[model samples]
Target chain A: MQLALESNAFFWAIEYLATFCCGLLGGLWAVRKRYDFIAILMTVWLTGLGGGIIRDVLLGIFPPVGVSNKGLVITTLLASCAVAVVYPEVDGLKWTMATLDALALGLYAVNGTQKALMYHTSGMTAVFMGLITAIGGGLIRDVLLNRVPSVIGDSHWYTVPALIGSVLTVFSTRAYARGVLSFTGELVCDLLIVALVVCLRMLSVKFDWKVPGAIKRKQYRF
Target chain B: MQLALESNAFFWAIEYLATFCCGLLGGLWAVRKRYDFIAILMTVWLTGLGGGIIRDVLLGIFPPVGVSNKGLVITTLLASCAVAVVYPEVDGLKWTMATLDALALGLYAVNGTQKALMYHTSGMTAVFMGLITAIGGGLIRDVLLNRVPSVIGDSHWYTVPALIGSVLTVFSTRAYARGVLSFTGELVCDLLIVALVVCLRMLSVKFDWKVPGAIKRKQYRF
Candidate 1:
């Protein structure tokens, strides 16, 4: 089955929408970290586009779409500024931001996997590419903010849901290619994966579910 | 007349040696950060080869040499283990590490710029690529360790010399291409650039030279 957002204009809109939301979260994170406005701008750009750059670079795509696309750049900057301006009045908007961020993550995870599959990368590689696309920006942001990546820490199941969604994409794509799944079936699967991630993330957060690490927490103490 | 280390076995040895040194530093950093053994291994891999992965990816080189080169991988892991075992005896080895790291940085900067020029990238892009190659791993390392990148902050003049060396490479390569500079001249220029960077870095450290940032110290207070 054909991917619903692969070549559609609506996909571009959704991608930019996701970019804006991600940028907003990045800006909010900077503000909370007490970073200056310049740092906020840097964080927004990094968090909004870092994943795409990494995915494309790994796939050997030159001048990564993130770097070449002016619209994405503008969206990231504008969204960051808007977040900064609205942050003080949005004291109770934490859940709203988290929900939106999760949705964006789901979309990006699927999209990254699709691109990797299109490049004929292995299923494993596609899954990894998808995870990077979903979490890369945040990793860059956290690193710049001088912290271990949340995805690597004993945080909520951020990488897990992205991994699942990516695996689903690869599986669905392969099935579609073999005539086992129709285009409509593929579309349904895509939607289902996104929904699954959103639900999984919210549940993980609500229940305070944390991934167990290899080492005890005391070892992390410096 | 030739670039002494371009394709020589000795060049390969130096590259691997640099890899070992970088990996050792990474492992030492993990020890200081109170990270577990697994994290030390991860950091070693990241710090030893992260810059080259980034450089090649930006240049659209798939699988990154760092990924494909098993020798480099083994070197990083082994070096990390060695450092872990020898950490206690190396408490007084700060200058030794710094000098070797500067050498690696110079080599990487020049090599990255040369590669970019070979690919016909613009001079400005070549400079940026070179700078990235030289500093990228450390930037990643610092971020993972929960600190701002020294290159971005008012630290030693790490990036400046790399920039100068990169510009020199681009200019010298262009001159050689135009037949204005002899092959020997180009080789000499490359060596000079690397030497300049190494000396400048050492002097900067020795003299405690710092590049002052625009904002005052108080502004950085959270």
Candidate 2:
């Protein structure tokens, strides 16, 4: 399973696509912040590769691909430059941005889980790793910009889809390992999970779905 | 050098002391934010071990000692509990907190550089690693709390000592590698670096020193 996934062209495509989308979003964020050119470049790199770097480091992968991969470095730089050049025009394309963000989230979640599984981590750890890989970049971006991380504080159902997708990936991999699912079946399952996550995220955004707070919203000052 | 440092009781003590001081700072910050018990605990862990975790992961160490070491984990938890129980009393000890924080910064900076050197990294890389190790936890904490990371935005000289200490560590280690210094001299060098960083930090705080901003105080709206 590991070897197959490692050589799969589809997996590589997914990774590249996710990195580009996340990088674009990062660029948009930096433009909005009015950061300098160097800072914008840094932000894009952090946003696009931060999650994978965290996951790889935790998994003991040295010199994480985020820093070592020349292709990824160029992609992030390009994304930042694109934003810097035409931010006002790009900023108006809200739907396009949201769609790309959702796709990146789903792709990252699936890839992170699969990578963790490939490294022989427990199912629980795989799911956790997937969540980190999917959202870690955004978390770092928000932190750098001095904003509350949406995953923890926002009402939107951002984390739910990623969590579900990661769990599904783990389950499908386990099934494949047990010979309960065929090779093609596992691939199909991975695709399905990505699609499911994207749909869930988009639907939540469209419907303004939110997770409820622990207590009823009667103002309680600390 | 790696073997000697690994076996040094003094190195172990420095690591533990840094962890304890950082953990205490984290706990205090969480309490100040009026966070719940669980949040406080998480904050403490992140603040105390976040820098080391990042350093270890970047260095390709698995299951970072931050999470894998039972002793370190227990120490962080205890620090959080202490903050929760007597935050008011502890809060008044400003001088003590500042001193401890300075010491932790020095210890972390020195240790981070030495660890990178031990791993045979270039001097430049070792210095960068040391800076990250000393400030990464506080950066994480600031980000989680939705504040601009002091290292980037504040006027204070927070990062100066760490940077200087890291550079010095690299130079001394290089001297030892070239046979210009003995093992005992290397140890002495490390201690002096730490003391130098601590004093620099403390003096900066005492004198209210600040790093100048790029632009003069003039209203410039984006």
Candidate 3:
């Protein structure tokens, strides 16, 4: 039990730290557009915490964002300052932003699913939460920036990958929780699931893949 | 009882229309930013649906962003095209945007309180929901644009006024629902409440009122 608790804490640290990194990239991206300082900070704050905030809030919990709690505030501040100070040193900020975004999406997918299932939400709900957690911030950010949300646009299976990852995690953990799978089996399963999501996301992007939208109309050409 | 349902539906319409205006501003704003057609459409969609999305998600309900079903997509396209076509001819777009934002805030406050009360949540929760519903979208937008959130940064008494509006809405509403206040009386009360809220919010901006944040030293700041 103690070991499990420690593992969870370690997971939290990685998740929060990843969130901060994502925020830095997001904030720096906005700054490059010469958006006002306040907007920059808010973007960073939103990208950093938006997914977790949605996960927690939708679970009927008080989000750390709402609390403006210390750990969250500090991590974001560090990331924001880093971007402000070091943005000059990066060669391809855009690429870095995209890379961090992918990493953030992967981390949030696994972590969010774990959290939801731990709270005993069903598998379907857990997967939904994972997708929401992975894409929610970006959706919010894109909407705010007035850009086509990456998830909803010509998607490279972005959302579906996250959904798959979360569903896999839930199934593995469900077996372990029910004493059907060994601990080692669950761990391996979790790693494999994460790999699947990350690989699929990368491949889809590399191959220019997409899920077909419900309608494909070239309705206006005149 | 039937009248109460009608009245609630009426308030919901008010909320929906206000959101529509916000969406229209977003579309027009996107055009000014020189976004592609799809991007313009997404921006307007976000503006229209962003706040309410946050409101419902935080309330642990299915987000109605996609709930308008087919109309959600069609209306977004229609509003975007309308704004794109007319924004060029529209004078004082900024003023219109600001006015719509203020109006949205008021309606969100009222709607949030009413919805929460309907769900049987605590009054305090209802007030918090109201404030969040009002500011969540623009805040999300500012963050994505990498600007300081208007409400959190410069707008003093911004969220506070929303709270006042929400309190009035729910309080008078509870009275009417319990038969302590006559239906006609409650109607008068509700309108008075909305008027007061709008007045307070507009007045705060005019007078440079502010919400105090915890002391932050930018020397020690993000």
Candidate 4:
């Protein structure tokens, strides 16, 4: 499974695209916060690569690709520079930026689950890893800025799709391992899961769908 | 160095003690925030073990001791319970708790440096790892609660001691590796570094020492 994923150029393309999008998002966030240049650059890199680094470290993969991959590092720096220069103009493309962000989230979820399964972690752990990969960077960014992580504090449907995609990926991987699903079948399944997550996220955002908070007003009792 | 540290039961004892102290601090913070029992427990575990886990993961250590070691996990839980039940009483020992916390910070710094050196990381990386090990847990805890990490925001001399200790540890380890220092000498040096950090931290707190912020009043320009 690892070999198949590694050998697939499509997977690499998606991963890089996700990194770039995440970097851009992070850079924009830093700019909005009025952070200086160095901080903006660091924020971009962390937001783009933090999750993968955390995942790789957990799996005992040394010198995580975030730091080791020159291309990805360059991508983040480029994102920093781009956001720094194009801050005002980019505001007009909010929806476009958000769509890309959603795609990145889905890709990260798929990639994290694949990596966890490759490391031979249990299905439950793999799902957890996937969720972390998808949201960890944003979580770190929020924490660094001293804000409650939106995933934890907001009533958004962000984590739900990631969780669902991860579970589906694990199931497909299991089928592939058991020879009930072919390599191509597994890849297709993975792509579909990503699509499903992106769709769910986008729809939720468009329709203002929300996850219930710890206490709904109707359920509150003095 | 790795073999020596691993073989010495004293190293393990200090590491566990540091973990327990960190857990207690984290639990106290959570309780103060009025978090629920589950959040308090999670906070304790993260505060106690987060730094070591991050260090080990960065060094590619699988199943970090924090999660894999039953004893350490139990220690954090014990800390959680203790803080929950003895919150008010613990406040009376403020000075004592602060002293222990300083010691824990120093020990974490030493252990992180040692582990990074064991993995053949460069001296600079080792020092960085040491700082991370010493303060990563607190940073994570602060972030979770939507506050700026004290290490970054507070004018206190918290991180300075950890940085100094890490740098000193690296230098001593280098000397030891060059055969200029005996095994006993190295161990003594590590203990002295820990002591130095503890003293520096405690003294800073006692004297209200401060790290300069981004702008000093005299240097401020409108």
For residues B1-222, write the lDDT of model 4, one tens digit per residue: 543444588887876777777788778878898989999998999899888887777777777877998988998988899999998877778888888899989988987887888888877668768987898888877777777666655556788899899999988888888899888888889899999999999998889887542121232222
For model 3, what is the C-alpha lDDT against the true structure?
A: 0.68
lDDT of 1 by residue, B1-222 (tens): 244347578767877887788777767777775555555766787788888888887887775766556788789879777766676544358788877788888888888888877778899988888888888988877777676666777588898888888888888888887889887777778778878888989899899898876676665655
Judged by whole-model lDDT over C-alpha atoms, candidate 2 comes out at 0.79
Taking the tens digit of each residue's C-alpha lDDT, what string does model 3 give over B1-222?
A: 323323776765665566667777766655565545545655676566666667787677742443233444456667777776666533256666666667777777776777777777888888877777777776765555445666666756768877889888778778877989898887777667767777787777777777766797767745
| lDDT of each residue in B1-222, candidate 2, tens digit only | 553344588777766776877788778878888889998898888888888888887887777878899988998888888889988877888788778888889888887888888887767668767877898888877777766765656546678899899999889888888899888888888889889998998888789887542222233233
Candidate 1: chain B TM-score against the reference chain B: 0.89
User: DockQ (C-alpha) of model 1?
Assistant: 0.17
Best by lDDT: 4
**Scoring each candidate complex against the real one, what DockQ results?**
0.17, 0.17, 0.07, 0.17
Residue A132 error, candidate 2, Å: 2.6
Evaluated on CA atoms against the true complex, candidate 3 attains a DockQ of 0.07
- Please give, as one word, the docking class of candidate 2: incorrect
**Error in Å for residue A182 of model 1:** 5.5
TM-scores across all candidates?
0.60, 0.60, 0.53, 0.60
* Candidate 3 runs further than 4 Å off: A1-13, A63-69, A88-97, A217-222, B1-222
Q: Considering summed lDDT, which 10 consecutive residues are worst modelled in model 4 chain B? A: B213-222
Better of 1 and 3 by DockQ: 1
User: Share of real interface contacts recovered by each model?
Assistant: 0.29, 0.31, 0.06, 0.31
